[model samples]
Target: MRSFHVSKPRVITVDKNPAYPVAIQQLKQKKKIPEGIQIRQVKYLNNIVEQDHRFIKKRVRSMLGFKSFDTATSILSGVEAMHMIKKEQIDLRD
Candidate 1:
């Protein structure tokens, strides 16, 4: 979150229910966050990320396990980089 140059970010978190107050309080003290930047809380919107993780985990499980740390890293890095690149392409197309 801090890596992105987004202020007043609308955070969409997921759990059985929304518990955004704790997260908002924690963010309040962070020096990097600017004042007056509203932090909006959203719940049950993280299913997409969770679903994506499920596919990646399935791929890992299919391998029985990673043979080496580097191989695992390479696979995941490629997956993430490709996902980002493709997402940007889609956004541009829109």
Candidate 2:
């Protein structure tokens, strides 16, 4: 959330985890996230997000672990870029 530098989300969808409610409550009390923001634990919504990143997870899982944070970051960024290109979400210009 801090890294994205985006506006506060009006809603946050997460899986049905016991800890999520506690953590979200703490964040709201600390003014980290808006108090009015809603949290949905619909399995379908979570499934969609997981499916979208399924490719990335499969690729990373085979690697076992990354040697360094910098290398991991670069590799993951490249993976995401390639995914976007394949999806035609990015246009290439020479």
Candidate 3:
């Protein structure tokens, strides 16, 4: 939340996690978040964030199984690097 640049957000979308609203209330009391900022706990609203992971999930689902944690980490790192390159967020030549 600190990474976001909004001075005063009208609404904040969050999942149905119990701690989320409590955290928001704490922030509101501390003047971190606007007093009237709406905390939306809609379950389906989180699909927006999950949508980006679909591609990675699809690829992972096709794999038989990772040999170990290290293997999974290495493969995921490569997948992410490829994604970054395809999105032009990172230069592959670098």
Candidate 4:
């Protein structure tokens, strides 16, 4: 909201979720997003996010559910660590 008020972007692309338009309307009512700002709900606009989430989702589903916050955090941390390894963004030494 701060960015919207400060920069006052000309156009914003969001998911095709119907809730977004309503939320934007609320923002306009609150004078956050400018009245003339264009809000586009594009399909496949969030594909990159969805793709990234898929990897995490797969691991979580396979585990069914994590028993505790510490375990969940540690497990997800390792998952992301391996992902970074595969992407060559980080190196783990033996």
Candidate 5:
């Protein structure tokens, strides 16, 4: 979350995971996240985002696992770039 360097969100929608509520509470108590932020435990709200990453998951599953964080980060970044290009989401010409 801190790595994104974005403004605090007003709401966070997550899957019905048992640990997420506890984790969010802990972050609030530690002042890492705002206390007033709303948490919604919805099953389908995340489907769109999850669907978008399905291709990446399928691609990485064959590799078993990455040996280093730096290598994983580099490879994942390239994968995402290629995905965007394939989807025509990014314009190649400057």
Candidate 6:
């Protein structure tokens, strides 16, 4: 996962997950990130993603459970589309 923080209106700090470490390591070793870019080894910051799981659980509960995988998938597909449409209206700016 990649995270970008905006300090000012323009300044950005991008933190890429280093769980594997190889990608960042290679980028640094090959100088792909360039000089003056600070690459700090950080602990896993998975709280945001973890917190979102509760919503999935809530959605599941809202469905009242499915008897079969196909039924679950069908319900999920429709629910996901509805959710996307609702969210896109709020998120997508023309």
RMSD of each: 5.7, 3.6, 4.9, 5.4, 3.6, 8.4
Q: What overall lDDT goes with each candidate model?
A: 0.64, 0.85, 0.81, 0.83, 0.88, 0.58
lDDT of candidate 4 over 30-84, digit per residue (tens): 9976799888878887655556767789999999989999999999999988887
What's the distance in Å from true for residue 74, model 4?
A: 0.3
After aligning candidate 5 to the native by TM-score, how far in Å is the CA of 6 from where it should be?
7.4
All candidates: TM-score: 0.45, 0.75, 0.52, 0.54, 0.73, 0.37
Model 6 segments more than 4 A misplaced: 1-55, 89-94
| Model 3 lDDT on a 0 to 1 scale | 0.81
| Clash count per candidate | 0, 0, 0, 0, 0, 0
Over 1-94, each residue of candidate 6 has an lDDT whose tens digit, in order, gives 2346623222122235544356655766897654445544435444444444555578889778788999888877777666667667446666
Model 6 clash pairs are none
Off by over 4 Å in 1: 1-5, 8-12, 16-46, 85-94
> lDDT by residue for model 3 over 1-94, one digit each (tens)?
5666846668887778899899999998998767989988877775566566777897788997687999999998998888778879886583
Residue lDDT tens for model 5, 10-77: 98878888998999999999998889999888977855666788888887899997889999999999
Q: What range of 10 consecutive residues in model 6 has the weakest lDDT sum?
A: 6-15
Order candidates by lDDT, high to low: 5, 2, 4, 3, 1, 6
Report the poorest 10 consecutive residues by lDDT, candidate 1: 9-18
Candidates ranked by TM-score: 2, 5, 4, 3, 1, 6
Question: Comparing candidate 4 with candidate 6, which one achieves the higher TM-score?
Answer: 4
Could you say which candidate leads in lDDT? 5
Using lDDT as the yardstick, the better of models 2 and 3 is 2
lDDT of 1 by residue, 1-94 (tens): 5566755544534444445556656766786544555644445455666566765787778888888989999999887777777667435453
Error of 1 at 92 (Å): 11
Candidate 5: the clashing residue pairs are none
Regions more than 4 Å wrong, model 2: 1-8
TM-score, predicted candidate 3 vs. hidden true structure: 0.52
> What C-alpha lDDT, on a 0 to 100 scale, does residue 51 get in candidate 5?
77
